[model samples]
Each structure stands twice: as structure tokens, then as C-alpha cells.
Target: MITHRLVRTWEVLPSGGYSTAWAELTGRRLAARGRAVGLLPEPHWVTYTLDTGDDYVTSRLRVSVDTAGGTRTVDLRNDAGRWTVDGAYRPDLDGALDCDLGLCPLTNTMPVLRHDLHRGTGGGGSGPHDFLMAWVSVPDLAVSANRQTYTPLAPDGQGVGGPRASRVRYSSGEFQSDIEFDERGLVLDYPELATALTR
Candidate 1:
């Protein structure tokens, strides 16, 4: 990943308060400025991929919020506009934690992120394609090729948290996202990599 490294700063919201962040990504960084306002620390950053041919466009934001309960980051990914939480998940898998879950519903309108030819073109996958490239704690169930269930982050024994990473490679796209787990399969916090700082 020799791509330019981006840096951003954010403020925590007062429970239901508001927050915002900004970044300049340029030379080695690619000349980008990103800004966002939201209730949660919700990810806000400038993401530019030479592979996507968006050098001129400002990168979209994926923010991490620091709140009363804990710190969290909602990372948006791929050219399809998918989203993921990069922090202490509530352990409540009400909706499939899979980013593909959201991308599927928007397939008809999901913008095709332009990429290098080596990345391969979309073959019109039956579903929104596999956005499950993010790491999963569960492996017992087979990869359905489509967003089906809440891929457990810990299916081996008991998932709590640990130093582990789960990644789901897309079948037809250049997408990659992962979750670092504590020994218990629970998600951990990378204070250094956090998009926002708590007030």
C-alpha cells in the first residue's frame, strides 16, 4: 500500500451533540481536503485511490466517534459506497454486519468505482457482489457469494476480543476491509488510527 497516507482530526459529540473533522491528503499525499458534520464520530476523511482515477475529486469521509459508551468508527469502502463500523461493535447483529448488506440494496444505483483493468470489471453479479471481504469471526458457514447472514466475527469457540484479523476477498472487485479482534474475537481500538478524538 504505497498509496499516500491520509491524516484527519475530529471532535467528540456531547451525547446527542454534533461533531466534525477535516483532512488534507497532497505531493505524496495527493492534494485533498475532506470535511464532515454528523452527530456520531461517524468516519470523515479524504480517500483518494490512484486506482480509482479520482485524483481530482476529494475523498469521501469515514469517521470514528468517541462517545460516552466507547469509541467507534464507521468506515465506508469500495466504489459501491458500502459502510462498516471499525470499533467496539454493540455485539448486537440486528443487521448483517456485512457492508455488502447495504451495497446490495443499492446495486441498481451503486456507482461503479473505476479501477485499473487488472482489477477486473463487474460481471453483473446476481447480488451486490461480495462485500464480505471484511474479516469475519465465523467460518463454519460457507461463503454464500452474496450477503446472506451476519457473518459472526467469532464462530470458532467464544468470541470476546483478541489480536486477530478477518478479511473477505471479493469475488469480482478490488475491495478490502478487515476487523482486528482481541483474543476473545471482540473488536479492539486503534487509538492511533482513530479518525476522531473524544472531547
Candidate 2:
């Protein structure tokens, strides 16, 4: 039984692609389905479904990609901090709390919500928080473990003349960007990556 629902759309900056997602909240769990079309690296489209626990930690994910080579799919599950892909245990992703789907901004919401980073509290006092992520590659469905960090930035006053809109600095190795998020902790703008569309 779903108690709440939300929908969001984003425009992929570099490749001129677009994605739309619909999410449902039932009890303390959340489930979402999304589709994305892009031409980066190659021309392709992707569809995915995600389920998360009460804490916004990813529990299961399934992704399907379609390209000139046809379509391939991958299923991943996280149970008690342990991870499995395509029914095979992956110790490398054991402790990962979330899945960073390549080129998908929705994946960032979990960490932000969990740590209250959007409210400018969690990461502010404790500094940046680090996490191991189950990173999924686009159009390939390949999974790997990656390390990333999120640090809260001061409010930029883009919403309601208050801190309704927030920023978080996302870093993975040499790549870093200051991502702006809306009041509900959804990505509003990700420099050089994507931007939320008013739909």
C-alpha cells in the first residue's frame, strides 16, 4: 500500500538525454522506477527499478539497458550490508549502503536523506561522510565497488529566501561537483552532469 508518491524529471547535460522517475513510499520503504535515454559512449536507453529500506539504504536494484547490441539486464540485492549480483555473492560490495547508478541523479538522494545533509546539519558538524557504493555502469549493467564522499555546503538561498534549497559537494577521486538539491532532497542541478526539469 503506497502512502505517498512523487515524480521527477531531469535533462542529461552532456549527452542531451532525459530521464523521468516515479517513486512510491509505503510504510517505511520506498520504491521507484525510471527510464533514461542517452547517447554518451554510444546510443542507448536504460530502465531501472530500485527499492530501499526505511533509512534510505538501497535493498534491491534491477537495471536493463538497450543498445544496438540488444538488451541486457542485471539484478543486485543488498542484505544486511552484504551484496549479491545476478545471484552471485559479491564480497567487494559487502559494506556498500547504496548503489550509484551511472548518470542517474536519483541515486544521490539516499545518502543526502539519510544524513540530513539537505537540512544543513549532518555533514556540517561531522565534515564529509564517506561511503562505499555499488557503482553500476551505464548501458553495460556491470557492477563494481567505488568509494565516494558527500560534504554539506552552506545554503545558497535559491528557495523561499531561506535554506530550503541546499548544496552538497560530491567527490569521487579526481571528479567533484557542487550539487544543488531542492527542499525535498531531490537533485535540482548537477554542474556538467544534469539538471532537474520543471514538468
Candidate 3:
């Protein structure tokens, strides 16, 4: 039962957004708890807990948010390849492979680093890997595993493995960013968002 801990500060980049999180990893399973306050353009307090296994191919996510509208809690999960939200199976999410909790990019580390992701290798971003993710939106408390894409980037000097460190761009709708991970597949930094490491 090997356990690892990590902490990261979340920001909105060049503005006044602040939050922090603590995460624990045991073997291939991960459990994380986090809180955010004063996230730019919106004033609210948000808290979340996320758990995953099999290299993040499956997950159970919970989140609560307090804002001018009110407070609400959301719970979601993906077992094997099946997805559920607030204890109900979602037929719309059939055949999804991952969960994107809209809260943090760290969750992206699980599949990008652990899966045998040769989807976009040497293709100049041609064959982008599409992850059918159980997506979550905190403030709205909406949950679904729509469609998201992860595209591998060229290698760079950083950690271990054949390419040392790796990069991947996560895209959904109009959202996208290049995320870097260490050799162990943990996120080193998420552009304009957060940086993380084992403690």
C-alpha cells in the first residue's frame, strides 16, 4: 500500500483567483480533495473529492459549490467503461473511457501517463485520442461525459522513460492547453493553472 501526497495552488493567471488542493495516490488508485475560493469572474467556494483506478481509466467524483444562487452537491463515477452520476447510470455516456472533472487538469494525468497512448505519436497531432469523459461542471453542477480530445506533443527534456517527459494537449469545445507530465505520469505543470509533484 504505497501512498504518495501532493499539493498544488490554483490560479487564474495574471489575476486574483486562488485555491489549493491535496491529493493522495496509492498504487494505481488516487483520491484527491480540494477547495477553491474567489475564482475569477465568479465568487464562490467550491470543494471536491476525486478517486480513480486502473491508471484513471475509471473514477468516482464528488463536488460541492456555494454561490449567490445557492449550494449543491454532485457525485459521479465511471466503473470499467460504465458511467454513473449521482447514483444513476447514464445511457448517454455509453462507451466513454475517461472522466474529465472540469475542475482540475491533474485528473488528465492518469490516462495520459498510464495508458498505452500511441494515438498521436509521430502524426503531428493528426490522430488525436478522443476520450469519452464523464465531464463535470462545478458552478452549474451539470454532469456528463461528452467528448474530449487529448493530443500528444513532441518530447522534451524533463523526467524518465524513453522520452523522459511528455506533453499532451487537452481539448473540449473551445478549451485547450498543453499539459506537461513527469516520468511517473504525474502532472508537472498545467499551463495557466497549476503545478504538482509528489511529496
How would you encode candidate 2's per-residue C-alpha lDDT over 51-114 as one tens digit per residue? 9987888999999999999999999999988899998999999889999998898888888878
Q: How well is each residue in 10-85 modelled by candidate 1, as lDDT tens digits?
A: 3323222222222222321232223323342332221221111142221222433333555444443333323223
Off by over 4 Å in 3: 13-16, 116-127, 156-165, 192-199
Best by TM-score: 2
* CA-lDDT, candidates in order: 0.25, 0.85, 0.67
TM-score (C-alpha, index-matched) for candidate 1: 0.21
**Which candidate ranks first by lDDT, i.e. highest?**
2
Pairs in clash, predicted candidate 3? 133-145, 135-144
Q: What order do candidates take by lDDT, descending?
A: 2, 3, 1
lDDT of 1: 0.25
Better of 1 and 3 by lDDT: 3
Q: In terms of lDDT, which candidate is stronger, 1 or 2?
A: 2
Worst 10 residues of 1 by lDDT: 101-110
For residue 68, model 1's alpha carbon misses the true position, in angstroms, by: 0.4
lDDT of 2: 0.85
